[model samples]
Every structure is written in C-alpha cells, then in structure tokens.
Target: DDSLRRFVTFEPRANVAMSVNLLVEPTRSDADAGFIVLQADRAHPMSGSNCICVVTALLESGRVPMSEPETVVRLDTPAGLIVARAACRNGQ
Candidate 1:
C-alpha cells in the first residue's frame, strides 16, 4: 500500500527517530487527512501527541491552510476520525 511504500522510503534509513507520525491524504469523506503512526517495528492507531504532531505538520507545512488565530483539521486514522485545532501566526 501507499503507506508502507511511504514508510520504506521515508523512515528506517533516514535519521528520523522511531515512532513518528506519517500523515497521508484521507480516504474517507469525513476526514481531511489520514495518518499512520510509525514505530520502530509497527504502525499503530492515532495517538494524542502524534495527532497533535500530524495536525501541526499539516499547518506548518501548508498542506492544510492556517487561519488567522486557529486552524481546524480532521484526520482519519486506524482508530477513527480526529479533529484538531492549531494556533497560527503569520502562517506559522
């Protein structure tokens, strides 16, 4: 699948620490994105901190736009859908 392909290409060999969040485009209508929480050996469902990380990444990387003071993003995970808000300033 695309998720495994992405993990193989982006993790393990890279310098990134293990158990990082890998965000993908959502396959469901209710979500704006899909995320796979990569660990040293396996992938897990969405976690609180990782969810925050994914949301932050979306806003910081401009994959999702940031609003004046806050940006809301919905993520689809193995567990379920997660909605999050991020603080923004000057598009950061």
Candidate 2:
C-alpha cells in the first residue's frame, strides 16, 4: 500500500500533517458514491468533517446533480449509510 500512502501524503512544506484518504466506489443507483475514510493511518468509524467534505466535493464537482436550493447526497460508509442535505446557491 505504499502507493496509496504516497498518494495521500501531505507535503510537509504545505504545513499539513495528515490527509484524509478516501477509497471511493463507483456510483450506485441508491448512492452517489460509496467510500471508506482513512485517517491517522487507519480506518475511522465516521467523521463529520469528512462527510461534509465528501458531500461538497460531489456536488461541486458535478459528480452528483446539484439542485438550486438544496442537494441530497447519499453516502455509503463503513459505519453505515449517511444521507446529507447540502444547501446550494449559484452552483456553489
């Protein structure tokens, strides 16, 4: 898994100590994307920040369709399924 470790490594010059590593699965009918979150070199049960980031990344990147007022994102995680509501404006 050296490749994966290298991929997730944050450049020390950037002042980042660690980075969240997400293994994203193909989009499913029920969920936009499924993923497992890895942090501190191990899998975590869940992370609020990680979930929020995932939702935002999906919508903003057009991985999931964005609605004007709101976007619903379904995330499949190791803990369980998470349904997140994202407030959107001007494609942001």
Candidate 3:
C-alpha cells in the first residue's frame, strides 16, 4: 500500500562513525566517465546465489544510473570482488 512505501525518516550510515572504515565505504566515481562500477563482497552477510543489492543514483551529482535485472553476481566468499559497470553522463 501507499503507506508502506512512504518515506519515514533520514537515517545516517552508522559505519561512518568509524574513521578507518571510511576507506571501506561504498566506492564512488566522479570521472565524468559515464559509468559506475560495483564490487560486491562475497562473504557479505546478505549475499547468496540469489542475493542481490540495489544500486542507486546519487541525486546531488545528477548522474544517470544503470541496472541489471536478477543478476547472479554474488560469489562464494569475500576473496574476490565482482565488478559491474553502469553508464552515466556529465551533460557533455
């Protein structure tokens, strides 16, 4: 229902509370290269053969996003990362 999908509150990422983990935050690019790359941690608690994550466009920068449907991307363990790219535009 509409109520179930409504925005409730703004929640800040708790991981940012630590300084060192800043390097571990979700990677972002500003190269104006018209693409986004995603690397997933295999051992990520939410990962499975059918597990998936949502990639979203950051509104402040005005970059377009791309997504693949039902992609089987998760790996077995956090040994190697899976790389996926999404197209973007810099208004150029």
Stretches > 4 Å off in candidate 3? 1-43, 46-79
Worst 10-residue lDDT window, candidate 2: 9-18
Which stretches of candidate 2 lie above 4 Å from their native place? 1-17, 26-29
- Residue-level lDDT of model 1, residues 1-92, one tens digit each, is 45663555464554345566777778899888899887655677868988888887888888887887988898999998888877788877
Candidate 3's displacement at residue 57, Å, is 7.0
Clash number for each model: 0, 0, 1
> Over the stretch 1-92, how does candidate 3's per-residue lDDT look in tens digits?
32211212112322222111101333334222221112221112323221222222222233323333321222222233444343333421
User: For every candidate structure, what is the RMSD over all alpha carbons to the true structure, in angstroms?
Assistant: 3.4, 2.9, 13.4
- Could you estimate the TM-score for every candidate? 0.75, 0.76, 0.20
Candidate number of the best lDDT:
1
Among these predictions, the greatest TM-score belongs to 2
Off by over 4 Å in 1: 1-17
Residue pairs in steric clash, candidate 3? Answer: 34-88
- Candidate 1, lDDT over the whole model: 0.77
Q: Which pairs clash in model 2?
A: none
Residue 58 alpha-carbon offset, candidate 1, angstroms: 1.0
| Model 2 agreement with the true structure over 1-92: per-residue lDDT tens digits | 65554456535422245557374883556877887665445667678888898888888889889998988889878787789999999999
